[model samples]
Target: MAARSGRRRAIRGWLGKACTVIAAAVLVSSVGAAAAPAAPIHAPVLRAPAGGYEELWVPSSMGPIKIQVQWAARGGGAALYVLDGLRAPNDHSQWTSDTDALRQFANDNVTLVFPVGGRSSFYTDWYRSSSTNRQPITYKWETFLTRELPDFLAGYGVSRTNKAIVGASMGGNAALVLAAHHRDQFRFAGSFSGFVNPTFPMWNQAMRAAMWDEGQFNVDDMWGPAGDPAWSRNDATAQAERLRGLPMYVSSGNGMPGPPDLPYGAVNTVNAMALEAMTMTAAQIFRDRVAALGIGARIEIGNGTHTWPYWRQGLANARPMILDALGAH
Candidate 1:
């Protein structure tokens, strides 16, 4: 009931913000060649593939993004295009090492394409009115992956027809948006602990923080002093209902109420409280409204914060559902 109610609030909130997204998610221009050169992309340390896991990198328009391939050691099956999290570093990250997923899904005979290197572009092209997202101009990542990665995998023996895309955090939003906009690309999509709303005030704040770190999220560029239109379409909440038939898996923490301790010390008491309240509220909002839309989805809630340990566990819990969607043994 709580989750259901949370979904309602989210829907209302999203509906209210959709108009803003139209303006906020405005495509200004690509990272013009006139802009400073993009930072050099570093390659990930190639880790040894366990059993079915194979290490490789696929060519993308954005350059060569690293990929960890898990080939079906047995016969042959489907494919899963896994997306990474926000804090994905070159050395270690979720897409690079699912840890248990390879061993767990080996018998399923599916190929896993774990691509890395889209730091914060949300895996979308950005030529300011980009052909893909038609919003933002930080980078042109979306075109490279959706257009190129699949072909690369197909050449390597990953079945194109049975492919599924799943991700966490920002990547989840990408998975949802990509799947919704291009249903032909994926048969199923999953988003765990995703920052779905690009236009939500909270999401707006997060983008500001991320861009501020990279010297990109100027207050003006983000949303033009709040209430920006383009911002909302960038958000998952605003477009969640648009995804009708895609099998999506969306989950978030219960936003356990308490003072969250950072790697250092307690600096944000108020923010933590707000986050807790908001997460709890958003979960319920998504639950009810999405269910009403008749989209096949699975929602999980419990006592966990927005951390990788929790996501890893959640993946295990939902692995069966993934297999079910893929029609695997």
Candidate 2:
């Protein structure tokens, strides 16, 4: 584990430099430091929220990755993946700071994995590059959490199976993508105030209008650039057809454009003003596509914006669903 820490630190040291890429300049101006931090990130806490530990995960290909985990020490087993929204922080995210959701969920003895690093990788494995095209972002996360993280958890006496994946915004998409690709490991998936669409035109269709801001990063760069086949493969909503028994949770709010239904509140409002409308609309349409799926899932249009408070509020609807799934264990 110490070795893992060393490797993760090394990766972040390099990533801190590459965070100034052209795509970041275009994709999000407010997220300037999302890609800047090295691990051991600080959360502006009035006080520590409960108890948790931080660990570094190292994959053969990705080198080292920082993952902060929280869990109840005494109870049955469950694994939950908490993804960082765009502009992620290392120690804690809106996922923990914005609400009491973690208190409710962790009380049930679920293991929470928070992956912190908000580069262009989008938490996916790059198709042609193993850190080739992008030097700092090797994009080897697919293996680190999926293969090595779980093994590391077992060492800590954590649950190895009955995993549930969940997150908001980009993290939500990542949770879905991870679970969809590894159904054998992830029995349940959820996205709160999630960006649910991968193919903007094919599904939400609104993103094309709202997504061009900052430096104008084409979503394809995060997936595979335009005309690339990998885009088809990673489309989150498209993966729905392949999710036979896997249950899903997805939602989008009003902060995106005109509606004003951001789940979190202040943060969402700030983001709305700070971000380009194209980005918000893109996320909204993605959620709409999830609702369109009409699968054995839950998708809602809420009253708030995309702030942590709103997402925390949405959890009232989302929590039971996730717990019910985890209870299956």
Q: How many residue pairs collide in each prediction?
A: 30, 23
Model 1 agreement with the true structure over 173-252: per-residue lDDT tens digits: 77777777677767777777666656645556555554343223353432354565545555556676767877777777
**Would you give me the overall lDDT of model 1?**
0.53
Tens digits of lDDT, candidate 2, 1-329: 00011111100110111222211110111110112222322221111235433344534466556665565434345677777554454444445444555565544556666666644345667654422333444456667658877776665555567788877655667777888888778878877655555555432222221222222333444455544666655667667665656777666565343332232234334444332232245455655555576555655664444445445566656667777787732
Q: After the best TM-score superposition of candidate 2, give how far the Cα of residue 262 lies from its true spot, in angstroms.
A: 12
Cα error, candidate 1, residue 124 (Å) = 1.6
Q: How close is candidate 2 to the true structure, as a TM-score?
A: 0.68
Candidate 2 shows a clash count of 23
Query: Candidate 2 at 112: error in angstroms?
Result: 1.5
